[model samples]
Target: TKQLNFLLPDSDATVAFGKRLAPALKQGAVIYLYGDLGAGKTTFSRGVVQGLGHNGNVKSPTYTLVESYQFSEQSVFHFDLYRLADPEELEFMGVRDYFADNNVSLIEWPQRGEGFLPEADLTVSLAYEGEARQLTMTAKNVRGIAILAALKS
Candidate 1:
């Protein structure tokens, strides 16, 4: 497994880090985002969607559950499962369809969807650190390892 850490001094820094990870996702990936409320998960996701060619605003799918952005080569699905009442709800909503091999899926509050979601290729955790945030990325498979490797360079 590969692991990378970053100290983000602010929201912009977190978003910048997301942008750095964007290029490595051209082949698509499943990224699980772990963090408490206000930890910048949505902000980071916004950066990724934008980096992939989204020109409009990227809002959290807290109430809607998921939002999708389309680029020329790939699609990005941003999911916020904080409001999920049961994992089965994911199945009811056809959530599995969102994680296509050719698209990127960024899931926030993934623990809420537990068994219903696919295995993540990468996992990202963010935590509050003084006036900043600490971000950690862990590679769960070969695809993730390649992403981290790309970021290292």
Candidate 2:
């Protein structure tokens, strides 16, 4: 797997990076976001949603489990599974439908989804580094390798 590391000095920098990452996404891209509470996962996701042309707020789906945003070209699904009690609940919610070819899935607390979720093309992990944040992105497949390459370039 190919990996990239970034030092985000603040929330703005994290969002900026997410914006930069957005254009590299191919249709049906699945990205897993791994981070602790207050690690800026939602802020980064907001950047991705905005980068994909969503004009409104990109709030976390912590309670809702998933929020869908539609664009002319594709649909983006932002999923926060932090509050989920069982992974099987995803099946009941028609989670597989969210991974359709025309959609991009951004999942937080992906581990909670476990067997219910498809393999992520890319995984992004965020951690605290003093008052700043450190982000590590790993490519898990061909598509992820391409996206990471674009980000590097």
Candidate 3:
């Protein structure tokens, strides 16, 4: 699988990178966001949702757990499992239903749902590199490979 790694100097740059990556997000794609506190995961997601034709706001689902944005042709599900107490809560909430063929899921803190979460097509890890952010993306499946390829260019 192909891997793409780079640096974004600020939140604007991070969002710009996410915007560039948005087009490769096909239906049923599961993207995992890995980052610590204060990282730019939510900012990146906002760029993606906006790029996907959502004219409204994109907020973090930290307290709400999940947030959905509906578009004419597709739906985007942004999940923040940061506060999840147990992974089984995902099953209890019927998370599998969210993975439908026409839906796109961008998951933050996916580690919190570990065993209950579906396999991720792409994994994005963000870390601090001095004053900037270092981003590394790995492809876990064919769809992710295509997405990573898009980032490579």
**For candidate 3, lDDT tens digit of each residue in 106-128?**
99999999999889998889999
Give the lDDT ranking, best first. Answer: 1, 2, 3
- CA lDDT of each candidate? 0.91, 0.91, 0.87
TM-score of 1: 0.97
Give the per-residue lDDT digits (tens) of candidate 1, residues 1-153: 399889999999888888888998999999999998999999999889988878899988999999998888888999999999998999999878888887999999999999999999999999999879999999999999988898888
Q: Which stretches of candidate 1 lie over 4 Å from their true place?
A: none
- 2 against 3, candidate with superior TM-score: 2
TM-score for every candidate vs. truth?
A: 0.97, 0.96, 0.93
What candidate 2 gets wrong by more than 4 Å, as runs, is: none
As for TM-score, the candidate ahead, 1 or 2, is 1
Which has the greatest TM-score? 1
After TM-score superposition, what is the CA distance of residue 22 in candidate 3 from its true location, in Å?
Answer: 1.1
Task: Give the higher-lDDT candidate: 1 or 3.
Answer: 1
Instruction: List candidate 3 stretches off by more than 4 Å.
Output: none
After superposition of all CA atoms, the RMSD between model 3 and the true structure is 1.4
For candidate 3, give the lDDT of residue 29.
80
Residue pairs clashing in model 3 are: none
